[model samples]
Target chain A: MAEITLKSLAHSYSKNPAEPQDYAIREMNHVWHQGGAYALLGPSGCGKSTMLNIISGLLEPSNGEVLFDGKVVNSLPPEERNIAQVFQFPVIYDTMTVYDNLAFPLRNMKTPEARVHERVMEVADVLELTSQLKRKAKNLSADEKQKVSMGRGLVRDDVSAILFDEPLTVIDPQLKWKLRRKLKEIHHRFRITMVYVTHDQLEASTFADMIAVMYEGQVVQFGTPRELFETPNHTFVGYFIGSPGMNFLDVTVRDGKVFSGEAQLLVDNRVHDGIARATSDNVKLGIRPEFIEVHQEPVEDGMEVKVEHAQDLGTYSIVYASLGGISLKARVEEDQITPVDKAWLRFPSEKIGLYVDDYRVELPHE
Target chain B: MNKVYNNRAWWLILPMLLLVAFSAIIPLMTVVNYSVQDVFDAHTRFFTGTEWFVKMLNDPMLQGALLRQFAFSLTILAIEVPLGIGIALLMPKRGWQASVVLILVTMPLLIPWNVVGSIWQLFTRGDIGLMGWSLRELGYGYNITASPVDAWATIILMDVWHWTPLIALLCYSGLRSIPDAYYQAARIDRASKWSVFRYIQLPKLTNVLVIGVLLRFMHSFMIYAEPFVLTGGGPGSSTTFLSQSLTTMAIGQQDLGPSAAFSLIYFLIILLVTWVFYTAIMNMQKDDNKGA
Candidate 1:
């Protein structure tokens, strides 16, 4: 296994790119540590696949170096780099049996047939494909075909890493779960550096120890699932990660106090100072819906708002409310009294995030 | 529950039956009628009872033409399939060059069959043709009218030139339909170029190749216009194929009964061979399924 590093890597499909928008992947530096499970997560056209292709040596970057184990492998082809990639759709040799499909990479390396058999059997056993060894790959189901493609990678022992480009896309939802579990098992057993590229947050969170969330051809944040949820570095991350996402209200600083129109927000002194020091006019207050407290009765220090509606989601209810024309959502527990047409809302100081120019501003620690 | 039958639905198929009869069955029945009887005139006829079929089948001249027809069809198929695939492989994948090459490759196929024959005939004229004059200048006697080997070679080369483009176009379309992901996967697998073709490309091309092969086989088996215009079955009938022989018997010599019988045999041979090819390919797929 090897640590794969992208050093200021950038790529543009155009012959002469004149603007940052032309680049599929903007200049950035990132690393997948040796034997680490990482996911490159983003929305469609967000350069996640482009970054994966650059790492696999399938597409040469227009600029910067891809270093493997501290050695620059910028000029090496995918085969020479000893990297395996499973594409979005399953790609297997239609004429070959599953056994032969698994043995293909080994055979290409001129590995001995005896060892090839051993490796194929081992991978097949792990994938629960032992009974399908003799069957033609083309005759198998979609998920099985995907497994065979993954097996083609697992059969080779010399591969430094296995890259997956949404390899479970063609699979059914139930099979997607099983195959994901199987992949997790493989990563744990083989300890190979695996980088999965997907547009799904749950897939990334479940499959990767660390997720590099990309936005507009740039990696906006790289952190653990919990860290991304609790402390998103960019506004896009905050809006894109959690269900219903984080609620934000455009605010302005006046005398070291944050105001959403005419009413002043009662926030911590650190947030007040952070807003006072912010130079941009794009200052906003962000808070997760889950952390917002909603009470049917007005209390001291609580902001009164018009409750639009509440959606019962079994264990918890999401109350959609409006405060002086600004809309917000708050997740209230089922045991709590449901809010009526009006309710009191409170933004917990510890859970509140202050944003300036669409980026979270770190508040001074107490 | 009891099922009910609708007899009125039978009337719904009358139009299709009439269309089929007018387009196919009526014409085929005329040939069958002629084959089964010796028609001296429209009103006067005698029952032949397979007598003409026996005579036509035993005719040595017809037998020689039949053998030559199979040899020509098999030879041209063997040459065209591989050459077409090779051309497709060497073709540019995109850009203006790909369009230019496609236009150039399709030029021969666009020409009328008789026009192709006339073009080759002038192209190989001993007195003034480029190939024939060049061979004569080099002190080599390359006369299609005088030598059977030269005549056969010229006809085979002409057929290959005229038809290899169809196969190439089919194979090219087939190759284009395969996604880039297969190639990327093969590259990651470290597969050699030959292995890529053998495992990925050839398997994907099988469907198109089947269509190309069957079309070329049927077209070549019914060869008439080119050889008819160029050689007229000369050089002691060395390049005479079954269609030309049937044409000579039916239209030239006016042996309607025997020619009709020969036509039936010719039709059956093509149908039988095509069936065999189709079944062989389908059975191969069935075996793969059984293995699964």
Candidate 2:
């Protein structure tokens, strides 16, 4: 296994890219540590797949280098790079049996038949494809086919990394979880440097120890699931990580107070000082819906909001409220009283994130 | 829910039945009528039973032509299928070059059968044609009208030139339909170029190749125009295929009784051989352990 490093790597499909908009992957440097289970997470068309392809050596970056274990491997082709990739759709040789499909990569390397058989049996056992070994790969179900494809990657002992590009997309919902658990089990057992590319946050968070959140061709934040939820480094990360996302409101700092629209927002002096020294006028206050406390009765320093509606979602309820003409969502536990029509929302200072130009700003105190 | 048994719904198929009868059955019946009878005129006819059929089947000349037809069909198929696949492999996958190559490759298929024969006729003329004159100049005695071997070789080459494009186009479209991910996965698997073609491309092209082989077989089996135009069934009828022989007997000599019998035999041979080919290819596709 090898640590993959992207050093100032960038890519553009255009022959001559004049502006940053032309880039599919904007210039960035990132490192995936050796034997790390990492996920490149983003929405559709966010360049996560492009980054994965670059790391796998399927794509050559237009600028900068891709280093594997401190060696520049930009000139190497995918086959020479010793990497395996599972595509979005399962790609199996239709005529080959599951045994042959798993043995394909090993056979290509001219591995002896005895060892090939041993490896094939081992991988098939892990994928629970032992019974299917004699059957043609094309006859298997979609999830089984995906497992065979993954088994093809795992059979080769020399492979330094395995890149998955949304491999669970075609699987049935019930089997997706099983296959995901199978992948986790495999990762724990083998410890090959695995990079899973996915648009689903839950899949990424569950499968990856660290997720690199991509936004508009750039990796905005790389952190653990808890870290991303607690302190998102970028506004896009905050908005993308949690369900119903983080609530954002445009605010301005006047003297030592913060006001969103015409209504004054209660903020600690640390936030007020950070906003006061902000270089840009594009300032936003961000807070997760789960962190916001909703009260039916007005409490001290609580901002009054017009509760438009509340959705009772079994375990918890989401309060959709408007404060000073800005929409906000607050999550309330099922045991708590549901707020309706009008409610008071409290934003704890520790949970509040100040943003300037779509980037999180650190308050002076912490 | 109770099942509705509608007897009247069967009448809705009458139009298709009438169409099939008019298009196929009636014409076949006319041929059968002529085959079993000595029709002196439209009105005056004598029942011949299987006399014409026995005579036609036992004829030495007809037997020779049948054997020659099988050889020709098999030979052309063997040449065209692999050559077509190779051309498809070399073809550009996309861009303006792909369009240009496609149009160029399709040019031969668009020419009429007679026109293709005429083109080859002029092309292989011993005195003036490019190929014939070049062979002559290069000290090779290449006379299609004199030597049977030259005539047979020339006919095979002409057929290959005229029809390999159909197979190539079919295989090209089949190749294009395969997604790019397969290639990427193959690369990641460290598969050799030949391994990729053998495992990925050839298996995917099986469906189209089946169609291509069957079409080429049927077309080549009934081929009359091209060889007839170029060689005229000589070098002593060396290149005389079944269709040319049938045309000579039925139209030129006007042997109505025996020719009609031969026509039926010809139709059955094509039907039987095509059925065998189709069944064999389809059987190859089924799972080995599962007998169908």
Candidate 3:
């Protein structure tokens, strides 16, 4: 296994990129630790697959270097780099049996027949494909064919990494969890460095120890799931990670007080000072819906919000409210009594984040 | 679930049945009727059951022609299939060059079949043609009229020249349909060029190859124009194929009863061979084992 490093890497499909928007991957420096399960998470066309392709050596970055274990491999092809990649669709030799499909990579390397058989059997067992070993790959279900593709990667002992580009897209919803758990089990057992690229937040958070949330051809945040949930470094991350996503309210500074319109928000003095010192007029306050406390009566440090709707979602209810003419969502416990028309809302000091020009500002936590 | 009985669909199929009868069944029945009778004229005919079939089957000239037809069909198929696949592999994949090459390769296919025969007949003339003149200048006695070997060779060459492009076009489309992911995956697996062709490309092209083989077999079996024009069944009947021999019997000599029998036999032979070819190809796709 190898730790992959991208040093000032940038890619553009255009021959001469004159602007930042032309590049598929913006110039950045990042490293994946050896044998770590990491996910590159983003929406469609956000460059997650582009980054994965760069690391796999299937694509050469237009600018900088990709070093595997601290050796420059930008010129090397995927075969020389010893990387295995599973694509969005399952790619198997249609005429080959499941046993042969799993054995393909090792056989290509001229591994001895005895060891090829052993490794193929081992991987097939792990994938629960033992009974299908004699069956042709084309006749199998979509998910089974994908497992055989993954098995081709796992059967090779000399592979440095396995890259997956949304490999579970064709699988049924109920089977997706089973396949995901199988992947986690395989990672723990073999300790292979796997970089999974996907657009699903739950899949990324569950599959990887850390996620690199990408936005507009750049990785905006790289952190653990909890860290991303609690402190998103970029506003895009704040909006992209959570289920309902963090609520962002546009604010302005007037006389060292942060105001949404005419009413002042209860934030710490450091935020107010930061707003006062900020040069850009674009400022926003971000807070997760789960952290917002809903009180039936007006209390100190709480602002009265008009209740638009309350949705009871089995475990908890989401209260859609308007605070000073700005729409907000606050998650409340199911046991709590529903507020009629007006409810008092409070944003926790530790959960509130200040932003200037679409990036989170570093404010002292209370 | 209870089934709904709807017989109106039978009415919907009547037009197709009438079309098939006019197009296929009626003509075939007329041939069958001619095959079973000895006719002096349209008014005077005698029912001679199985006599014409027995006479046509026992004719040694017809038997020799049938053998030659099989040899020619198999020979052309063997040469064209692999050659077409190779040409497709070598062809440029994209850009202006691809379009130009595609146009050039498909040029021969668009020519009328009779025109192709006429062109080759003139082109292979030993006294005036460039190819024959050049070969004669090189001190080789390459005459299609005198040597049976030369006659057979020229006819096969003319057919190959005219028809290999169809196979190439089919294979080119098949090659283009393969996604880039398979090649990428093959590279990642460290597969050699030959292994990639054997495992990936060849297997994926099986459907197209079946089409190419069946079409070439049937077309080559019925081939008459090219060989008839180029060789004219020359060199003492060495290159006389089934269709030319049948035409000589039916039209040249006007022996209607035995010629009709021969025509039915020839039709059955093509149908039988085509069915065999299709079945063999489709059987290769079946899985060896079915599991629970």
Candidate 4:
């Protein structure tokens, strides 16, 4: 395993790279520690996959350097970089047997025949592909094909890192869970620097220890999955990293509390009013769906919202509600049978976030 | 009634069946008639009982033509298939550029076979044609009309130029159908360029290459026009192939009985050879699929 550092690495498909806005991936700096299971998480077109491709040497940055093990690999091809990548779809050699497909890379590298067979059988056993070893790959199902794709990547232990770009996209729902569990086990056993790229919050959270939240060509925040879920550093992150997503309500901050126009709420005394000094008076309050407690009565000093629709999804019910002429959503426990029209909403103050123009506010002191 | 009729759909095929019978059965009957009889005039014929077939069986011209046909087919196949695949491998994979390149490659296939022959005929002449002049300038004694080697090379070159595009286009289509994910998988496997081509690209191209081999083989075996125009069976009959021999028997010499007998033999050769090729390719494909 090896540590990868991206130093001011920027890229733009267009020549001249005329402006900061011209970059497909903007200037960024981060060191992915050795043996760390990290994820590049973002919406489509956010340059998360672009960054992964760059790290793998499939693409070169227009500027700066990508240092793997403290040596710049900007000029190296993906093979020279000694990294394995699993794509969104299974890419197997359909003309070869499944065993041969897994054995191909090792054979190409001229590994001893005995070792090649042993390594292939070992990985196949791990993936439960031993039964299909002699079977022609053309007749295998799609999920099986993807396992071969993965097995080919995992076969080479000399590779410093293994990267995956939404490798579960084509898997059947039942198989996807099993594969994810298998991948997590493999990562733990191998301790390779695995960088997984996905836009799914649940998959990212469950698979990756560190989730790097990306927005518009920038690494907005990189932290553990739980940290991202609990304290999202950006408005986009808060909204993106949840199933029903976070609810955002435009509010005005006054005194030591934030007001949702006459419905006042209090929070922990942190994030110095330096947030208010940011030149924008328009502030938005962000809260996870699970954090907002819904009640039947006026509930004395809680915010109010009109419930539009409630979706009962077995384990939990998500309520689509509106407040102050803006739509908001709240995910509550399945036990809460919320009525339509009127409901008392309590935004658990300590868990709430404030963003001015999509930028999150950081508390000055605890 | 419609559902019941679906089970008896051969009723809908009666006219087509009659059409096929009239075209195929009538000609076959006439050929058989000519093959076994002696004909002095269109209306006056006598049963000769395999007399022409016996004579055709021993004909030196038929033997030479068959040999020439095989040589021409093998030579053209060897030249065209690899050339076509190479060009395809080098062609761009996407965008308007790929379309433009496709059109350029398709241009040669669009040229009429007769026109292709005529064009090569003019282009291989001694005095003014660029090929002859260029070869002479380069100090090679080259004259396609008079030399068998020159004739053979010109025929091979002409066939390659005309038919290589077909193979390349088929290969290009096969290449394009490959998903990007496969390449990604190869990349992650840290596969080398040669390994990727050997294991991935070549295997993917096998089906298209088989199609190309069959097509080019059939077309080259029956080739008459280009070499006919360029060499005209001169230089003591070096460029003469089966079609020319068949035409010489039926039309030029007007030996109807002998021609009819020879035609059946020629048809059998092509049918047998094509069957062999088809069966061999299918067997290989099946084995590969099972092993894969």
**How would you encode candidate 3's per-residue C-alpha lDDT over B146-237 as one tens digit per residue?**
99998899888988888899999999999999999899899999899998899998998899999899889989998888888778898889
Per prediction, the TM-score for chain B is 0.97, 0.97, 0.97, 0.90
Q: Candidate 1: give the clashing pairs.
A: none
Which portions of model 3 miss their true places by more than 4 Å? Answer: A261-263, A364-366
List TM-scores for all candidates, in order.
0.97, 0.97, 0.97, 0.90
Lowest lDDT 10-residue stretch of candidate 2 chain A: A249-258
Q: DockQ of each model against the real complex?
A: 0.69, 0.58, 0.75, 0.50
Q: Across residues B1-292, which tens digit of lDDT does each residue of candidate 2 receive? A: 9999999999999999999999999999989988999988878999999999999999999999999999999999999999999999999998999999999999999999999999999999988899999999999999999999999999999999999999999999999999999999999988899999999999999999999998999899999999989999899978899999999999999998899999999999989988998899887776775311
User: Per-model TM-score of chain A alone?
Assistant: 0.97, 0.99, 0.98, 0.92
lDDT of 1 at A279: 87
**How does each model score on lDDT?**
0.92, 0.92, 0.91, 0.84
List, residue by residue over A60-106, the lDDT tens digit for candidate 4.
89989999999999999887888999898888886788999999889
Worst 10 contiguous positions by lDDT, candidate 1 chain A = A262-271
- Please tell me which predicted candidate would have the highest DockQ against the true structure: 3
Task: State model 3's lDDT.
Answer: 0.91
List where candidate 4 sits over 4 angstroms from the true fold. Answer: A253-278, A363-366, B1-6, B14-55, B92-107, B137-139, B180-190, B287-292
Residue A268 accuracy (lDDT) in model 3: 73
Better of 3 and 4 by TM-score: 3
- Candidates sorted by DockQ, descending order? 3, 1, 2, 4
Candidate 4: residue A70 lDDT (0-100): 95
